[model samples]
Target: MRLWHQDLLTFLPRAQILGQHRECCALRGLGWGKKHSTIDYVFTYSVKRLVDYHQLVLREMENRGYKPDQQWYCPEYRGKNTVPWTCTLRDELDDIPDGHIYPEHDDAYREECLANLRKKGIELFP
Candidate 1:
């Protein structure tokens, strides 16, 4: 699965935004460290980067009046069917990392995401 560029989070359609939230949850949980070509770049950095990126998706969802479970704030809160939370505890991040959350989320990646959306008949203008 792919994370639509963060810049597009605000403009993503409802389905996409929700899908992104699920994607983030998967990445944080069962999908962590799994090699998938579309999102391999995400594994290069700390899991904190994914958490930081997820905050954007959560914010946009909240802005649209959707209330996602706050439990997601924990870096290890995997959704359904997994070990008990206490066994997988991870230190909560105190602050977002400095600079771009993912250095790979550059202008080129933004345009690439936009182009992918266009292919899906979802046109978004920057």
Candidate 2:
């Protein structure tokens, strides 16, 4: 369960983009605060950070003509089984520097994600 570097969102294949939405939902729901090595850093920040990241995934999905359920916008919205409209206002990261929502998503992490994707036979160039 990794949040692929945001820079790669536009280039990610459909399967990966959809899977990222699911990952965000899981993390925002029961998976919140759970310790998974690949994404442990996520738990260290405010839930808003995840929400902000998920917004990027949603935008990419929309750009590709995929209609993601709007309910996922709420930080409290889990899966379809759970209730939607739990929160109307969402938090946003202020003044994101270098176009990265998270500090950990630095140049090194971006290359790491690219390498990992290459291992899976998916090559995305920035």
Candidate 3:
């Protein structure tokens, strides 16, 4: 997972890692000790398209049959699930820094993220 993260950073240096979660799972049908926890990351770049990117990802996760944690999202945003997932940074800062929005990509970057997930063999279900 670390290697994958590093490679992704190398490829998308301007990407901002919004959040990540780590959980342990068995590997090769072995017991818990056989492998370490895996880290799943959430990233976004352009502030202009940040909400768009979030919507796209949530849609893909649903299409792929992956369950998203309800706690991390807002219940009443621009029409329920239409807004970006609740980002703590937004509350903390009046405006997102210019650096975070730079080196951003459009819809193409979304495809790349999905491809990376496929390569990692992440089903989230099944």
Candidate 4:
């Protein structure tokens, strides 16, 4: 676990090691991939400096049901994640008429859509 945490820290510089836990169920073989034992992890982070931050981002992510722990490790792709993950990202892009979030804006039309994707930390691929 220490090695794995070290590897993750390379990318997540601000990440702090909280703890790890074993999963209760064994993954079953499915079309997605071979089955394996699941391991759960916990992590925390804090901003280096104070700035504008909104709890709305967290709410949007939770509302969108982006459970990486369950989605990445679980063998069965069911429940709230029935659709392909790519499909979800594509759907989000549809909300952006101009399709850019970096250049922040104040337009109300883009507020809901932009906030939903940006606040939730969705990565856009070129």
lDDT of each: 0.82, 0.84, 0.33, 0.24
Give a tens-digit lDDT track for model 4, residues 50-124. 001112222233444533344433222222424432323212322222422212332543344343435547422
Q: For every candidate structure, what is the RMSD over all alpha carbons to the true structure, in angstroms? A: 2.9, 2.5, 13.0, 17.6
Residue 45 of model 2: what lDDT?
A: 76
* Regions of candidate 4 where Cα sits further than 4 Å from its true position: 1-52, 67-104, 108-126
For candidate 3, write residues 1-126 as lDDT tens digits. Answer: 321222233233212222211111111012212333331122222222333234343444445555655432332233332443354433443343443322333345545565666666643223
Error of 3 at 75 (Å): 8.6
Task: List, residue by residue over 1-126, the lDDT tens digit for candidate 1.
Answer: 899888789999999999999999888888888999999998887777787889889999999999999888665666776542453335554343345678777889999999999998998774
Which structure is stronger by lDDT: 2 or 3? 2
What's the candidate order when arranged by decreasing lDDT? Answer: 2, 1, 3, 4
Give the top-scoring candidate (lDDT).
2
Whole-model lDDT for model 1 versus the true structure?
Answer: 0.82
Q: In lDDT terms, how accurate is model 3?
A: 0.33
TM-score of each: 0.84, 0.86, 0.26, 0.16
Off by over 4 Å in 1: 83-98
Give the winner by lDDT: 2 or 4: 2
Q: Which residue pairs collide in model 2, if any?
A: none
lDDT of 4: 0.24
Of 2 and 4, the candidate ahead on TM-score is 2
